[model samples]
Target: MKALISTGGQGPDFEKVKDIFTHVNLVVAADSGLNRLVEWGIEPDFLVGDGDSIDTENVATKKYSYNPAPRDKDFSDTELAIIKCLEKGADEIILIGGGEGRLDHTLSNVGMVKKYAQISLWMTSKEIITILSPGNFITHHLPQTQLSIFPLDDHSGPVKTRGLVWELEHIDLNQSMSLSNRCVDSEINWEITQGRFLLLATYE
Candidate 1:
C-alpha cells in the first residue's frame, strides 16, 4: 500500500497537496498535522500522535481512527505515524509538511528516511528528498532543476550518473564532497555500487 503521512511542520499548499492525496492509498496525521488537514477541509484515515498540539475541540468533531501515543514516549509523533503506516502494510511512504520546522525535528525526519531506506521513503516540501540505496535508479525532472546529492554513509563508492550538469563516474563521494548539481535532461540515471546517498530535487 502507498501511504502519505502529514506532519506538524510547515503547512503545505493545499492545492498541490490535494493532488498527492488522490494518488495515495491512505493518509495519516501526526498531531498538529490534523490541524493542517482541518484547514484543508480533509480528514485523514488515521491520526497518530500524542494529541498535545492538536485542537481538541476541533478534532473532537472529526470522524477518524485515533491512535494516541504517550507524550513522554521515545519516538516523535511523526515517527509514530510512520510506524502506524508500516503496520497498515505500507510499502511506499511519503511525508508531507516535513520541512521548515524546528531544525532538530527537520533533521530527525531526514534521518528517518535513512532508517527506512529498505522501503521507498520520501519527504517533500518545495523540494522532494529521497535516500537512494545501493542500486540503479532513474529520475525524471525538468531541465535546470536543482539536484543535489550527498553521501549518507561515510563513503559512497563507485557512483555513476548521467544527464546532470556535473556527472560522476566511479567516484568516491564523502561527506565533504557533496554534489550541488542540476538536471540537464528529462531523464537522469544513477547507479551506486556501495553505500547510501541522499538526493534533493528542488521544485521550480
Candidate 2:
C-alpha cells in the first residue's frame, strides 16, 4: 500500500493532499500535522512523533498513535512517520507540508531522503517534487518551470541530463556545479552517474 506522510509544519495544499490520498491506502501525520489533518477534515490512519506539538489525547481518540520521546535516540518526526508507514507495509510515501516552517526543520525533512531509497514523492504546492538518489528519473513539468539538480554528496561524479533547455553531458555537479535549467517541454529526464543528487523540480 502507499502512504501519505504529513509533517509538523504549516499544512499543505488541500488539493494536493486530496489528489494523493486517492492513490494511497494510508495517511500518516507527524506531530502537529495531525491537527492540520483534522482542520482539513481529513482523517489520518497513523500519528508518529514526539507528541510535544500536538495533543496526544486528540490523537488517541481519533487515530493510532506512536509517540516517541523528545530525546529519542534516532529519527526526526518526519523520519519516524515514514518509518512507521513503511513498517505498516507501505511501499511508497508521499510527503507534504514539510517545508513551510523553520529552516532547520526544512533541512531535516530533506535529510530524510538520504535514509530511504524507496520511491517517494514530496510536494509543497509551490514545489512539485524534490527527489534524491543516483538513478534515472523522469517527471512531467509545465512549460517554463525550473528544475535544479545538485550533488547531495561531496564531489559527486558526472550527471547527465536530457530534455532540458540546457542539457548536461555527464557534467560533474557539486556544491558549486549544481545545474538549474528550465524545462523545454512537458517531460524532463536525468541520470546520475555518481553520488546522490537532489532534483528540485518546480514551477513559480
Question: Candidate 2 lDDT, tens digit per residue, 19-124?
Answer: 7777888898888878877877788887777888886566667746565557565778888888888899988888877666689987787677666755467776
lDDT of every model, 2 decimals: 0.79, 0.73
Clash pairs detected, candidate 1? none
Using all chains and alpha carbons, the TM-scores for the candidates as numbered come to 0.88, 0.83
Clashes of 1: 0
TM-score between candidate 2 and the true structure: 0.83
Could you tell me which 10 consecutive residues in candidate 1 have the lowest summed lDDT? Answer: 117-126
What local lDDT does model 2 show for residue 108? Answer: 84
